[model samples]
Target: MASPIHQRLREDVLASVFAPDEPLTEAKLTERYGASRTPVREALQRLEQDGLVERRGKAVVVRTHSAEEIIDIYESRIILEQAAAAKAAVKATALDRQLLTGLLTQMQQLDPSDGRSLAETNRAFHAQLWRATHSPSLIGLLERLDQQVRRYTLTTLTYPGRWPVVLADYAELLAAIGDGDSARAGEVAARHMSDALDIRLKMYAEDPRTL
Candidate 1:
C-alpha cells in the first residue's frame, strides 16, 4: 500500500505550504498526518535523502536554497535543458512528436483559471521533452534539476500576464524541436529557461518570502 502520510507531506513541501527552514519535529508531522512516529520518521528521512529537508540540531527543517544557489540551479537547468532539446531534435521519434502534440493540445485546452492543473500539465510537458532526449544520464540530471526547480515554483498563471508569456514560450520551443533544428532548439530552450527564471525572480522580488 502507498504511504499516504509520506505522500501528503511530500505534497505540502512541493506546494510550498511548508516554508523553508521551518522546523519539522516527528511529533508535529505525526500529528499533522494523523500517523504514528515510525511512518513520520520514515517520511522525513526520505525527504532528507531527496534534499528537500535536512536533519538539524534536534529536528528536521525544510531545506532552503540561497538566492545564489537558486541562480546556480537555473544556470545548470538552462545548460541541461538546452542540450536536451538539441539532442531531442535529433532523436525524437514520430510517437514522441505525437505525444508532445497531445500535451500541447492539453495545455491549450486547459482552463485558464486552474493553476494547479496548469502546473501539473507544465511539468508533464517538460518531462516529456527530457524523455525525448533518449539519454538516461541527461534525463536523470534533468529530473534532479526539475525537482529542485519545483521547490521554488510559484504559480505562473496566477501572476498577472504570466500565463500568456508561458504559453508562448512553450509553443515556440515545441515548434523549434518539431522542425529538427538543433541550433534553433537550443536557442529556444535557452530562451524558455531564461524566461522561466525571470518569472520566478519577478515574483520573488514582489514577495521575498515566496522563495
Candidate 2:
C-alpha cells in the first residue's frame, strides 16, 4: 500500500506531467519533485496504473492521446459534463456560483502561452461544478475520465487560437448555470465538448502522429 506521502507525490507527478512540454524521466522527476528514486518509482507506477503515464523501456513518460482515444474521451465527457452542468444548475449554492465566477474571471486573465495553467484551471472549474451534484459515484467516474484524457485535455489547450473559444463557451455555460437554466446549461456544456472534439479531430487530420 502506498503511504499518504506517496499518494501526494503521485498526484504531484501527474500534475507535472499535465504541465510538461516534453517527456519526463526519473532523474528529472527526482530533481523537480525532490524525491528519492524509490518513492518516485512508486509514485510513477501508481500514475501508470491510473493511465496518466506510460513506460518506454527504462524511461517513463507522460502519456499522449491518440485520435481514437481523444474521440472516445470527449464522447464520455460530453455525457458526464452535460449531466453535471444540468445538476449544477439545479443544485449549485450561492457559494458554488461565486467560486465558479471567480474561476471564470481567472481563466479570462490567463496568459495564452501558459497552457498548463489554463488546463488546470479548466479542470478545477469543471470538477467544482461536478461536485455540486453531490454524487460520489458520479464524481468518481468523472475523476477517472479526467485522468484518462489528461493528455488530450492538456494538448488541446496548447493548440493555437483555442483558448478564446474555450473561454467563450465557458462564459455561456456559466451564464446558463447562473440563471438556473438547466436545459440551456446542459446544452452549452455538451456543445462545448463537441467543439473541442471537432478541434481535436482537425488536429489529428493535420498530423495523426503528432497528436
Candidate 3:
C-alpha cells in the first residue's frame, strides 16, 4: 500500500505538472516535494497508471495533451457540463445557489493576473457546479475530467487577457443557474466549455509539441 507520504507526493506531481514546459523527474520531485526517492518513484508509478504522468527514457514526464485528446476531452466536457448544468438548474436547492453565489463573489475579488490562485478558485467553482447535480456518478465522472481540463486551462491562463473573459462567462453561467432556467443554464454551460476548448485547440495548433 502507498503511504501517506507517497499520496502527498502524487498530488504535488499533479499540481506541478500543470505546465507542460516543465519536465518531471524523480530528482526534481524529490527536492520539490521534500520526499525520498522511494516515495517519489511510487508516486510517479501511480500517476502513470492514472494517465497523468508518463515515462520518457529514464525520466518521468508529465503527460502532454495531443490534439486528438484535447478534442475528445472537450467533447466529453461539453456533454457532461451541459447535463450537469441543466440538472443543477432544476434541482439545486436554495443553499446550493447561495454556495455557488459565494464562490462567484470570491472569484470576482481575485486578481486576474494571479494564475495559480485563479486556477484554484476556478476549479472550486466547477466542482461545486458539478455537485449541484446531486448525482454521485456524474460528479465522479466530472472529477476525472476535471484533471484533464485543468492541464488545458493552465495553458489558456498563460495567454494574456483571457481571465476576464473567463470570469464573464462564469458570471453568465451563474445567472442562468440562479434563475433556475435549465435550458439556458445548459446552453450557457455548453457554450462556456466550447469556448475554452476552442482556445485550447488554437493553442495546440500554434504549437503542437508544447501541448
Candidate 4:
C-alpha cells in the first residue's frame, strides 16, 4: 500500500490545495502530516516524481502553470480525446454503451452544489469513454494528462449553465459511439474539449489560482 503521508500530500498537490508555487518546507510538511523527516522525504519524493511538486533548494514548491501551459494542455487533450472517441465509436459494444448510459444517469443525480462529486462523475464518464477504445497506452497517457489538468478540468461544473452543456456533449458523444459513427464521435469529442477549454481559459483569467 502507498503511505498515507504520500497519499495526502499527492492529493493536496494535485488539487492545488496550496497556492501555486507555494513553498512546502520539509519542516512544514513534517508538522502537517505529523511525521518524521524520513517519511515526509519519501512522500515528497513521490510527488516530485509525479510532477505535482518540484524541489527548490531545501523546500518543495507546488507546480504552477501559466496561461501558455494551460493552452498547451488543452491542445493535447483535444488531440487525444478525438482519437479516443473515434476509436471508441468503432470498437464500443453494447455493454460499453450500457455502462456509459448508467454513468450519465449518475451524472444526472449529482447535485450542482457539490463540486467534488460532480467532478468525479465527469471524470468517470470520460474514463468509460476511453475504456471503450481498449487501448491501454492511450488510457495510461490520458490518466496522467488528466492529473496534470485536474485542477482545471474539475472546475467544469462550477459555472452556472455549464453542467447541462457538458451533459449534452456527453450525450451526443455517447450517441455517436453507440451508433458507430466514428466521424461524428470524433467531432463531438473535439467540440466538447474545445467548450471545456473556453470555460477553463475563462476561469484562469478570472482567478490566478485557477491558472
TM-score of each: 0.86, 0.75, 0.79, 0.88
Clashes of each: 0, 0, 0, 0
Report the lDDT tens digits of candidate 4 across residue range 1-211.
5899999988888777897667988899899999999998898888787777877777789876678987888899899999999999998888999999999989987898788899988889899999999999989888877877676666668787899888889889888988899999999999988988888877877886755
Give the per-residue lDDT digits (tens) of candidate 2, residues 1-211: 7756466655665556344335566677677777777777887888788877787776777676667777888899899989988988988888988898899899999888887898889899888888877778778888888877664457787788888988888889889988999999999999988888888788878877546
After superposition, which runs of candidate 1 have C-alpha atoms over 4 Å from their true positions?
1-4, 17-21, 31-39
Which 10-residue span in candidate 4 carries the lowest summed lDDT? 149-158
Best by lDDT: 4
The 10-residue segment of model 1 with minimum total lDDT is 149-158
lDDT winner between candidates 2 and 4: 4
Backbone clashes in model 2, listed as residue pairs:
none
Candidate 4 has a TM-score of 0.88
Better of 1 and 3 by TM-score: 1
Ranked by TM-score, top first: 4, 1, 3, 2
How accurate locally is residue 52 in candidate 3, as Cα lDDT from 0 to 100?
75
- Relative to the true structure, candidate 2 reaches a TM of 0.75
Question: Clashing residue pairs, candidate 4?
Answer: none
* Candidate 4, residue 88: how far the Cα is off, in Å: 1.5
lDDT of all the models against the reference?
0.83, 0.80, 0.80, 0.86
